[model samples]
Target: MNCLLFTWRKGDGKLKIHEVRKQLTTPLGAPAYPWGPYNFRNREYLNILYRTDMEALRRVVPEPLAIDEPLVKFEVMYMPDAPGLGAYTEAGQVIPVSFNGEKGEYLHAMYVDNHPAIAVGREVSAYPKKLGAPRLYIDSDTLVGTLDYGSLRVATATMGYKHQPMDLALARQELSQPTFMLKIVPNTDGSQKVCQLMRTQINNPTIHGAWTAPARLQLFAHALAPMADLPVLEVISASHIITDLTLSKPDVIYDYLAEH
Candidate 1:
């Protein structure tokens, strides 16, 4: 199959072959998203790691990626100075898994409040990102993170703000690992045209401030955003971090379905 791109004329609405093969992204004249690698500064995070059931972990993590542990990382990010994506808040769930003996996190579900952020994330890197309401802020001495899909609450997390300085070196190492996700692009016939596992990681992250704290996480069942599908049995660890980093595109690791 061949890939073709075209646009419409201004007045008569005639089809114009204005395709630039190597040009960043699609829809020609007015691209909705900016081309990366995007830079971010003062990116704040409220990460709460929790334990879950092994059966639940196995159901979400795909094959070729083994479940390293029955653990899930519930994270809420506040991007204050993201260059291309603008300032937005995002929250998601990630699972600990290993691909071909390499340990990494599998991005299960993510929601952002920014339009461009959601567009770029889903189209560019194929990150499982959606447009949902997520917020991160400080309330009194607690760092709060909440996610909502429409009018229903999906998740809520709270931590003691700057309770104790975290191990920066360890935090940096953990953040450097590649994350795996599946990309599905459907064809006109309702068949999957592109189905593959993609790998992406933070390019270079500079941790400005990091801390560990006592935290709690509450996940509610939702129809659209089913984050609570992976139940939180116990909260393991929590971290609040401020960092600067760059976002890079993902590389296709494994093809799940091929057009024959």
Candidate 2:
């Protein structure tokens, strides 16, 4: 699966273009910083693109096989930091995302399988203390769908940090809070067939080292949607359980790692 993660800081006032540029140019442990084009003069925003693989993804993801699509994408927007309540604003907003470097003003919608009692436990889970939990617009088991104009669907997923730990304390913290994992399946050809999969993260307070989930089931749906005459594949969501904890040192570090 080829996935792209895009992050945007609240450019309102705290994060200027220069600071963003410096952060990108001088990331904590990287010897050489990665830089990209940002309309700094206009103070638009900065974007960093990461081409990663499965082994790297498994470090943070609890369920990798559940996501089997080829193109996964996500967008993070910096919420306007309001005094006292600023951090809460960005808690559960689904910022638009472009996949495969495609961008434009497009229509987009979301469908969430609604389930009851799912929100009760998510309230304080690692989410920003100020923003609180999302509004619980729909149930997880209930199928709520939307129509949009974008070429791709960016989906996001959240595993209970307390339930599943991903080395990073912040991720664990956010997991402590109520977070939603998204699965975006593009709708084309006027059929309910999902074209591609897009993944993303939502309601995270801190901004660094964030990752996006893969769109595996969405891709499978798209492939199978066309052949309605064939037996439809069943996709199920299981608990976020992590097992087999082990650490092994690599024999050698390659100068460059290629994407599959």
- The collision pairs in model 1 are none
Q: For candidate 1, lDDT tens digit of each residue in 113-147?
A: 99888888887778899889999988999999999
**Which has the greatest lDDT?**
1
Error of 2 at 180 (Å): 3.7
Clashes of each: 0, 32
Query: lDDT values of the candidates?
Result: 0.88, 0.23
Which ranges of candidate 2 are over 4 A from the true structure?
1-49, 69-76, 81-84, 87-260
- Give candidate 2's TM-score: 0.19
TM-score of each: 0.91, 0.19
List model 2 lDDT by residue over 1-260, tens digit each: 23223334665455554555555323345412122211111111011122234343333223212223211221122223222222211111121223334321111212212111112111211111121122111134221111111233322223222223234454334322322232222346554322222232222233234322221122111221111111113322212211111111111111112232
Minimal lDDT window, size 10, model 2: 38-47
**Which candidate ranks first by TM-score, i.e. highest?**
1
Report residue 119 deviation for candidate 2 (angstroms).
Answer: 16
The local distance difference test score of model 1 is: 0.88
Model 1 quality (TM-score): 0.91
